[model samples]
Target: MTKIADFRAMTPDQLSDELLKLKKEQFNLRFQAATGQLEKTHRVGEVRKDIARLQTLLRTKQPAA
Candidate 1:
């Protein structure tokens, strides 16, 4: 789990990598939920939030047009 401050400290590339990982996790979690094999159902929401956080931070770090 990464805090907002932690995301702030990461480089754009690192943030993107983390985002990709989270998305993959989110996909797997969704599959597990569909198959009734998910133990921590709450984890799906957490991963979603983390994905959003990383995307927000990455967008903020980008140069304006």
Candidate 2:
């Protein structure tokens, strides 16, 4: 789980990379659940929150139009 401060400290590029990685994990987790192979049920919520945190951090770093 990524702390909000950790996400805030990362550069936008780094945040993007992490976001992509988390999204991949999220996909895999969903697939596992569908196949009845999921181990850690709580991880889904953790990843979801982490993805949202990264996105929120990235958005805050962007320049306004």
Q: Best-fitting candidate, measured by TM-score?
A: 2
Worst 10 residues of 1 by lDDT: 1-10
Kindly list the per-residue Cα lDDT of model 1 for residues 1-65, writing each as its tens digit: 67788889899999999999999999999999999999998899899999989988888999997
**Per-structure clash totals for the candidates:** 0, 0
Q: Give the C-alpha lDDT of model 1.
A: 0.92
Error of 1 at 33 (Å): 0.3
In candidate 1 the C-alpha lDDT for residue 13 amounts to 97
6-31 in candidate 2: lDDT tens per residue?
A: 88888999999999999999999999
Candidate whose lDDT is highest: 2
Residue 14 C-alpha lDDT in model 2: 95
